[model samples]
Target: MTTSTAPLPDSFDPDTRRVPPLGGFNATMLGIELRRTLRNRRTIIFTLVFPIALFLAFGGQEEWNTTVGRGNVAAYVMVSMAFYGAALTAASAGAMVAVERAQGWSRQLRLTPLSPTAYILTKALLALTLGALAIGVVNIAGVAQGRPSMDVGTWIASAVLTLICTLVFAALGVFVGYLVPSENAMQILGPGLALFAFLGNVFIPITQGSLMWHIASFTPMFGVAEISRSVLTGDLPWYAVLNAVAWLGIFVAGAAWRMSRDTARV
Candidate 1:
């Protein structure tokens, strides 16, 4: 009699799970994102041109080459340019959410079999693919500059990190798009990303050889850029790993919280 009643189950149906068909959903969203990105000439350029332009402009001259110093410029351009993926995806995808909300896209999706979780996953997946494509192009351009010590494994790891970064930023984009006017997304997100890239080690070394560079060392972009370069060069800085993980956790929590708040808007 003492054990007649058991604790309530964690969920209504403990034996069943409700995880989304993330793989298929991700694939579907990726295909959609690719088509959307390709349709826009500007997106194509940002994903491909900017990195190569910077590489050619800076990676070519002997003075700039020497200034690129110890093969750092090639790596910096390669790594820093990956941020464009996050930037572009965040700008478009975030605004798209707001547009969809206003046009009742969410209502259509909700009425169908598409679960809310699946919908969110789709957005994140689209951002991840765009991130990969943008960053992958940058890396390919990098290969033209110098072989360095990079291998398939290095590139693979970098891609994984870049995708994670994209998803995290996409979440933030979701929140920002929800909060700000859809029209202003480009102005807000574009400049924010540019500033991050500049302050971080994208264009130059984070070590900047100055104590005033303290800000870069502590930023999210710095963590991303440092880890990206380290992984590509087979250096693997432990501190960058810790920093990235810490930022990922904080970013994820904040984004999720913000996303939940927007549920009412739709």
Candidate 2:
């Protein structure tokens, strides 16, 4: 006597398994990422509070009331601080991937239908959300202080530009997160960004056409800083825009390369 065996269904065949289209990139995945980021209390507090503290400390000087352009110098400092906060927040959000990767989340994600492009896009959106929040917090603080003065339209444009340019730092954070160990990623990035801010003239205004000004133009933060201030000064140099676009491209390419290498390791 012989026993009869039945063929399994297609769903039971590993080779024929179907994946959701587009690697399951959707609102649900983005919401999950946002929630996970919001749950990190340390990141939330630092990202939201640190910049406001800096602004209050540095932006309230009596000398800053003197006019620089359409607005007072206080408004310039406010925009600068806003940009810094956005960059810091976006970068921190992007770097959180290091913790996830350390937890073998990347490997788990590989087993799912999540594509690299989808993952990157979701992370970028999360960074933007955090960046905007940081910018808003600092801007509100500026308004509440009633010191930083600018035309309302210029204020709105500068804030928007600052938030948009922060995407460069978001890419930088992702690249660094993938390049280093989780334990050291933020340790290096935190101080490194402060250094970049100093060099990029975010913390100090370099004399235009001076040697230091030329050097600052090449730093990652310079483009964003200058562009964000352009609305107030009415000076939109092509080089500042180029600086931002170039750094953004470089960081994004680096992130994509690092992500591919990381995925390969898994």
Candidate 3:
């Protein structure tokens, strides 16, 4: 004879089960991500050193002593280098998802309770943390060099804007990571960012309203570069802000779309 199953309890409700907002993203996952990133020596060194080197190379020029806006050109260069470092670091941090995806780690994550939103959010926070570190190191280097001359208020504001603007690149990194194979992700991103930097006027100052300047205005890095320098120049054009907001929205949407596609495959 077969045994019969017991009846369901009155209090039991399957519909009551629900995932938390942001897929239950919290401090623990963020801490784990931060620790893992800190363990990568090459990333640490590259993010910290490269910008400082660039700053020292170009920011110390005697001609840069010419005063512009609220500070000298040396200060301007320093801010640019800081912004560059932050963007590079933030993008690299976000692109790390490619490595995890390549190793089948993302597939494994699908078995867990964690949602893609949580994973992406954790990575974004990690990117911001690393970006801030890059910004701080570059600014400290500028201070030690004593060539950069800007008021304390301008220094603080510029740094804050630089860090905030890096979120656009963080999203870009995530989108690129999902779009390309792991080995090729950084290969394309690294040089692509450098090119963006040049075209965006991060390396060389293009005169406002010039052909190159107009072209640079549409590039991803242009918004961040202009915003970061805005405090010193005492100008924050509406178009520059629009450029940044538009790119940020595009990249973030792209990342979410790609992440959905990736998870669907699993």
Choose the strongest candidate by lDDT. 3
Report the poorest 10 consecutive residues by lDDT, candidate 1.
Answer: 61-70
**Model 3 residue 235 CA deviation in Å:** 0.8
What is the per-residue lDDT of model 1 for residues 40-130, given as tens digits with 9 covering 90 to 100? 7765665567656765564554443332323444444555566555555544664566666666676676666666677777776666766
Alpha carbon RMSD to native, model 1: 7.6
Q: Estimated TM-score per prediction?
A: 0.73, 0.92, 0.90
Better structure of 2 and 3 per TM-score: 2
Model 3: how far residue 175 lies from native, Å: 0.4
Model 3 steric clash total: 0
Candidate 1 yields a Cα-based lDDT of 0.61
What overall lDDT goes with each candidate model? 0.61, 0.87, 0.87
Give residue 94's error in model 2 in angstroms: 1.2
Best by TM-score: 2
lDDT of 2 by residue, 193-250 (tens): 9999998888887898999889889989888788989998888899989999999999
